[model samples]
Structure formats: C-alpha cells, structure tokens
Target: MAYENLNFKKAHMTFDEGYFYMFDDGWDTLLQRLADGGTAFSYPLSDTIDSAVTSLEYDGINFWTLQDPGAGTITIRRWQVENSICWLKNTLNFSTFDSDTFTVEHYHTSLAATASGGTTDIQSASYGTVITSGTVLTLGPNSSSQYEDVTVSSISGTNMVLVSGTQNAYDSGDEINFYNNLWIFNNDGSGSLHKINARTGANITTYSDSEYDNITACTFARVSNVTSSTVDALIYSKATNLKYLNVNTMSLYDTMTMDNLKVNNTTIIVIYDIAIAGNTIYRLQKEAKYYGGDYSWTYYNYVLSTVRRFIDTVSISAYPTILPNNAVNVSEITTIVNDQYGDGVVNKPVSFTDTDSVGFITINPAYTDLFFGTGEAISYYKAGIVVATVTITATATQYD
Candidate 1:
C-alpha cells in the first residue's frame, strides 16, 4: 500500500537467505537491508573496505568477496565459520551425518539411477566387499561421476569410519564407486580440467576434465536440495553464462547465454550473484559509471531470473478402473501435476497410457497443461469388440 525508494551509489551488492547487502565506494560501510525493504541497517567497514568490495555474495551468512580491479583477490569472511552457512555451499561438498559408523550400502552410477526420490540413507543395492582403511568411496550418480568422495579411516561389521572432515552425503539409487577422483579445472594449458584423486593428491593433467575453456571462478549456485550429477552456476566470460556442471561426467552439462539488462542507464554489466531458492532463480547485478572524475555506480538486487518448479505429486482426475468395452467418450481421464504447494503446475510434460489397447486415450495438452483442461478423453470399444481391465496411468516427465 505504501512504498519508499532509496538511492545510493552501489559499488557492490550481495544477497543470501532473504537479505540484500549493499556497499558503496565512498562510505566505508555495509548496508544490510531486508529484501522486502521492511528494515535496513548500515555498519562501517572502513572506506578502504567498501571500495575494495567490487562484488560480494552472501549465503545467508558470511560474505564471499570478489574484489575490484586494484586488488584482484577472492576472500571469504564472516562472523564465524563453525555456525555459518558456509557448509551449505557448492564448493564444500559434505553430506548429512547421523553417526560415525555409516555403511555404504550401494554405489549408484550416475548413468543408471537405481534409486528414486524419498529413499535416503539406504541405497537400492549394497556393496558386499569388506574393506580396509584408506579406501575412498565416490558416491553419486554412476553415469555422471558428479559425485562426492568419502575416505575410510577404519571399518567394523558393514559400517566404516569416514575420515573426519567436511563431506557430503549420497543418497539411494545414486551411483557409488570405490574412488576419490575429482576433475579439478583451472585455465591450465596443461589441461582445461584435471582428473585428480582428492585422497591421493594425484593429478592427471591430460585427462581433459572440463569443457569450460578460458573461464575461471567455477563456483556453484545450488537450486535444488538434491545433489546428483549437476551443479548450477553462473560462469562469466565475454558474456555471463548459466552453466550446469555435471559432476558425474566431470564436464559442463550445458551452457546458456544470459541476456543482459541495462541498469545504470550509463552502461550495463553482467550478473554478479545468483542463487536458486525453492523454484526461483534469483540474481544480483552491478555496474559502474564515471561521473566527472569520480566513479558512480548502480546495483540491482534480487532480480527474478526464472521459476522452475518440479512435480511433487501427480493428481489424477476422476477415472474408471474398469471401463466397459462398449462405453462411449462420455468420461474424460485427466492428468494433473502438483508442486509441493498442492497447486497444478504448468507446461510440465505429462504422458497418458492405458493398458486396454482396444480403447483410445486422448490427451488435452491445452487444458491439462494450463491446469484447467476439461481433462482427457476415453473411448472404449463397442460391445463384444475386446474386453480388458484398462489401467490408465498418467505420469510427469519434467517441470517447465
């Protein structure tokens, strides 16, 4: 009902949790503002600090700083590391821990996913091997190798003691293997990415671990809570690109060029920070403009990039378990996809199938996709043509 607009020189910006932190070159202060603009506070970081903070990224707590031109350095600082959300980053791939003795029931390859959703701590399959200490387990999707490794310190029964450190957990149906290999990538002509064993510190420079050429700062922008074969990230070069890093394949899944938006009116720049919280992809942008001899700047916070919601459950409209062979197109079988909010999803791919081959199942893409379709059409065969208990099923393929 009411609004207020605050304008200040934006030298750097970051967003995490639900707050927007802004900094200016002149004032050695950090402006911590609530995302909704309900409240804000400013604290002194020293004029040197404010100007040096060319760009910043916040993971709800603490700051990952990308300094401006004069001081080309990447630094992370916060109140405290132990209680901070730094553990919830893509750079540090550690998993949920319940106890010291956890068993690696199975190793799911990235390619062939054996586990489905909701089945955690238990793999669909199990490894029968009785191992010793120092054996590293690479866990994730088998085909992708976009996995995390856990080194064993000792073993008892079927359980093993993981080398105490920060490690991410793997889930069921994920590909698990006996290796601690990681394809570390840097701009090395020796290699674009190196296939190195994290445990042994052995680097294979010629393995060609990454497809991202001439790019740096390969950090992750986590969207979904699940860790599998992919990591979402904003990779910058001549242009800002959205890249999916498949840890399984040890390469980039795909690259999408993000269309730039002009912010400062004087000039526009690439997005500086990105995060996927729930179904929304959020971005923070920055630009600099030289006024007189002094530089003026602009920063846009919490820009909605895109909304990608997944199907939590599929809702089926009223349908008959037993359809008469002679029944006409009187009844329609509809498919519905719902997110966690119990609302029908849009543009999500759904397929319809009926076991009774004698009848036809017509899918209403226009209606069903829009979440308000009349449903589906079911035309059963005329009497005495063929009789079978028709099992009509509707399933979701993807979320748009």
Candidate 2:
C-alpha cells in the first residue's frame, strides 16, 4: 500500500448527493471525487466577493454560505453550480453578527401539512414555540405552481391561525417551507444555546446548560430516513465535550468523548469542525502538546448507528420450542431481530411472554446481542405448569 500526506488549511465543508465540497483558507473551494479520490478541482473566490466564509451548507440544490466581508454585518449568499462554475443567485445582508455564529445549517423539516382552500387554521406539532402569532409562512414549495404565503393572525393552543385564508388546497406531506428555515446557533457565554429559526426570525428553543458554555462548532445530522423527527444537531465545545442535540426536543440525546493518544503525558485535544454523511461523522481535530510546543492536525471519521432498523423478521434460535414437563427441564428460548437488509440490529430491547401464564421467563426484557441481535430468555414449564401447548412470543422494540 502507498500513501500521500498533504496539508490543508482548516475550512468549512458540505456534501450534496455523492460529491463532497470544502472551502480551504475560507476562499478556495475544492471538490473531490469520493469514489476514486481522483478528479479533483479547486476554484478560489476573489476577496472582493467576500473576505472570508464563516459557514457553508448545501441543500441538494443550492450552496449557501455565511460570509464576513470585512464589514460589521454578515452576508448570506446562495449559489448555483453549472458546469463546475458557481454563479451567485441571491445575497442577504444580515446584521448582528457574532464570532460564535460561525456555522449555518440548511434545514428541511420532515413535516408536511394538509389544508383546504379558504382554510383559516393549520395544525402541527411543530408550532409549539417558534411558529407563533405574526409568523409568516410559505406553504407547499413542493412544485413550481403550488404554494402560498400566509401570515399568522393568532395561535390557539396547538393550531396556527392565519391572517387571511388559504388560496389553494394542500395535501398532507406537502412541503411546508417557512422561507428556507435554516438552523443556526448563537453561543454568547450565557451558558445557554439558542437555536434560531431563520424563517420567522424567532428562536426555536434555548437549551440552558453549563455544558454548552464554550460551544464553538456545530452541524446538522440526519438520524433516520423516516419522515418525522429525523434531524439532530451535533455540537462541539472548546473543552472535551461532544453531544447530540435533538432538534425537536431541544435537549441532549447523547454525549460522546474521544480519548487522546498520550505521547508526552501532556496533550490537549480540540475538535475543530464536524460534518455528517449518512451515519458517518467526520471530524477535524488538532492535538497540541507542550513538548517543544509540538502540534499536529488530523482528520478522523467514525460510523454510528442512527437509523432505527426495525424487526424485519424474527426467528427462533436452534433452542427447542417443545419442552418436557419435568421441573428440572429448562427451555432456553431465543429470538433474533433482523432488519430488512438482513443485518443484525444490536442493543434493541426484546421482551418474552407466554400465553395464559403457562410459563415464566427468567429475563422478561432482554436486549439483543451485539453479535447476532439475538436475545435469550429461560422459559420454564415446571411441575405446577399445565401440559397444554403454549405459545411463546418475543417482541423487539425499535430504537433510534
């Protein structure tokens, strides 16, 4: 095997379809072919356009970036790529720029709504906090000719009241784009992380915790391919902190800590940036040591199980289903959980039950194994148990 080492400046990254893109030195855009690691291209943007790009995101159609143009305000621009050339489509000048606001995420909710013509109300679980009165929303961007913009007159419990009425009918699962509702964050040393809904200019939620005091970088991640509650955000603090924040709940779902390799017993690890592709997370890290003031930067990637692979098929193991009525005889009943792709799903909860209380299972809620996704429970039909044939059922719980 052969290898090559190259140096690249720290930059922002995004992925669309099958191609990966990044901005090196905040100015040069590079596209790499993931299949063969060949066919690479680089295009450097002029300083007149924007001095530095703080954040970059691709939403399967256009590339969006937040830039610092040596001015007091921040500029958000959208670009379209044609024949490997990027053409600027639109630009938005935004004030109140903060240094901590260095990441931008293009958000597409897995939610859809249905409404009839002249309907004055829309119901959704997402209108809890951010979708309030006076919030204008653009509905049904699913096609070129099927959309209407409406303003919220008031909020009644969980329903949103429009200022006027719908102009056309909308079906369920239709795109409800609230003006490209992008997800961005602001960490102002308040020990609170504010998730801003760029569409309505309202905050989605504020997660108050000391763990997020030093947050420096974040990116959106996909949890599953399901239509509802599928997106999460990965946040990184300057300290040794990494966590997954559920977008809907505004709470921490999981935390991760990576160990640093010790060379001189004095090493500091810093996670620079993070990006997600499917279930894989790519992280750029810097390790600094006091020995001769040595430091090195490296890129690391890890694969995680995010999609909740349901039980496509369940089968009993080689254990005997028929057991003797003797008290000393024990029947080890095992159930296996397999996904539609015929792969084992680990750590899923499996419960064992019998009909009419004929037998008792030792482990009621056993978890699937890491090896074969199989859970075992001891089923005993002893002397007091009936001799009639009983059915044993195993149920697996889906997890995300």
Candidate 3:
C-alpha cells in the first residue's frame, strides 16, 4: 500500500524501513514518518521547485510530481536524481535516402505528355509513363506520380509512369523529379544512443530534444546490460510511444519493436508522473470504471514494474522521494519607510515573520492549498514602527 500527505507544501518525504517520513517545508515542520523512532535518509526538495505543486509521490530514491510553473497546466519533474543525460539530438532532417539506391539520372529535366486521359479545358495531363519512374517516393510527395494532380498508372526503375492529369498535354519536356520536404532532412536520429547519470535520482542533464516536444512524463529505469556505462542509461517514458532511451548514447527504441515496455494487464497506461525505486518503475495510471451512467476516474499511484518483468509486472509496493522545489529565493535586503531613523530591519530578510499586522509584504510562486513542492511558497507579511529586534529561544529534540 502507498500513502501521501495532502498538505500543499508537503516538501519532504523519505523512507525508514516500512514507514514514510513527511514534513511541511513551507512551515518548517519536524520530520514525521509513517512509523516512530525510525531513521530514514533525507531527500530534500531543491530550491527550484515551482509554486503550484499539484501532486507528489516517492520512488525510494527520489520524488516525482506534477507542477504548474504557471506556464503549463502540467510540468512533470523528478527530484534528487540529479544525473541527467544532455545530448545534442540529431533528429531533425536535412537530407534523404532511397531504398538500396538513388539516382540523379532517374530524374528527368523533361517529360512526355499525351492527350489520352482527357482532351479539353479539363485537359488530358498524361506524362511519359514508359521511360521514367517518379512514383515510389516517400514522405511529402510521391516521385512517380500517384497524386491528385498527377496519378501514375504503371512505372518502375526506367519505366515511365502512365499518369493522367489536368495538363494540356502529355508527351515530353515537363518537370519530372521528386520534390519532398522529407528529402530535405536526415533520418530521425531516434536510433541514436546517449548518456545517463550514474547516480539514481540524480538530475538529468538539460539537453533539448525537441523531437520530444509534447506533454511527456519521464523516469529512469536501471536495467542490466542495457548500456556500456557503469551507469544504467535507460529512460522509460510516455513522451510519444517511445519505450526507453539508452541515454548513454541518446538512442531510442520502440517498446513494441524491442518488446521493452509491456503492459501486464489491460490497464491502459495514461502516464502522469513516473518514479523509480529498487530497479522498479512506479507509474501513476488513472482508471475510470464505467458502472451504468457516469464514469468516475480513480488514480492508481505507485504501480510497480520490476526490472526482471518490468514490462509484464503489474502492481508492487515502493517508496516516494521528496520532490525538489523550484522556487526562487527572494532574499533581498531592503528598508521600508515608517518615520526614518532606521525603518525596522534591512539587509536581506532571511526570516520574514510578521509579529504585528501594520503593513503587509507579498511574495510568490503563489502559495495555494493544492501545491506540493518546498520551493518558493507565497507568503504575506506585515510590519510596523518601533519594532525592535527581539531575541527568541528555541531547542531541537530527537524524535522517537
């Protein structure tokens, strides 16, 4: 079974045996766990977490969460796993290739037209179909002429395609070459290999792979013999149907083609946040059971997938990590006007606690009741005159 704290600023969560430790970083609460007197490793949320932390979960080593950077509704992030693979993806195309062969001679600066298909203002557009083959082209357009404007009847290698079109004539001297945007680019470098961070929960290097321009949620899956590095560089994701990336080389593979990403049951995977622990991937799969009239969606968090049967295994128990908070530290020192002299305090206000409600100050990554990160929490504070700096006493105690 898995558990979570519903508190908005649930900044930290770690594991100690069977218990889960949690704390409110916004309010600086003490570390509280699932069980008492247990020692668990602390996974501190980073200072970069956004304000609108919608949800959170842990996968033993690191935390996975959905954040609203106020930019997009969903910004998926993983914490503590600092090692990220940054690569210059060579996925954009700038050239082309043919199956087994290509021919500059195959293209003719000329074509033969004939008045066979039609013969009026509608014009019988028939090109030389017994000498040229511009129909087997791929991507943008067919080279042989299987288009609405130019349709090929029969063509191959040196055989011309008997195409009929809206041309006034069809005999010879017409432009016949494959002009496709795909021919202007290179093959999708999706097969290219990449690197990975060796440490679990290590941040992935920020490299732009615009090819993955989508609402993609990703996580690492440490698999054996998957790469050449001591660091397992496989990234399992729902960023498009890609199964995993041997990030050690930035190379991607199909889950079906490679048989890597397999669904154990018929649970359709609608990926949310993904986290990994103990070589298992904990996915958040949402399910909506249809009873009679309406369907209410239920979330299944911590859906485990082991390394051995990572593709086939269904649910299993794992832990959650603390998601890093991406909040900006607004620690600038400033003085406010009251009656001059020495307006309250200055010099980078580290701790802004409003003892008196005189005037209010504001900050952001707007704090909400639904946030989950420890990043910059929005707070409102007020001040007044003659506020002398009062010393306070405090003591820390070990929890049992």
When superposed on Cα atoms, how far off is each prediction in RMSD?
Answer: 16.3, 11.7, 26.1
Highest lDDT scorer: 2
Clashes of each: 29, 0, 63
Model 3, 38-146: lDDT tens per residue?
4343344434333434334343333433333342123334443332311111111111211110001111233433333353212112323322333421111124442
Cα lDDT, model 3, residue 128: 32
Instruction: lDDT winner between 2 and 3, please give it.
Output: 2
lDDT of 1 by residue, 161-209 (tens): 5565423434445554553333333433433544444334444543443
- The top-ranked prediction according to TM-score is 2
For model 3, the stretches where C-alpha displacement exceeds 4 angstroms are 1-50, 54-67, 72-211, 225-231, 239-242, 253-269, 288-300, 310-400
Model 2 stretches with alpha carbons more than 4 Å out = 1-8, 24-48, 68-192, 197-210, 224-231, 234-238, 259-266, 286-400
Ranked by lDDT, the better of candidates 1 and 2 is 2
Q: Give the C-alpha lDDT of model 2.
A: 0.54
TM-score of 3: 0.29
Worst 10 residues of 1 by lDDT: 97-106
Question: What lDDT score goes with residue 382 in model 1?
Answer: 25
| Residue 70, candidate 2: alpha-carbon lDDT | 47
Residue-wise lDDT of candidate 2 within 150-200, one digit each (tens)? 888887665778899989877766655343345444444555555555544
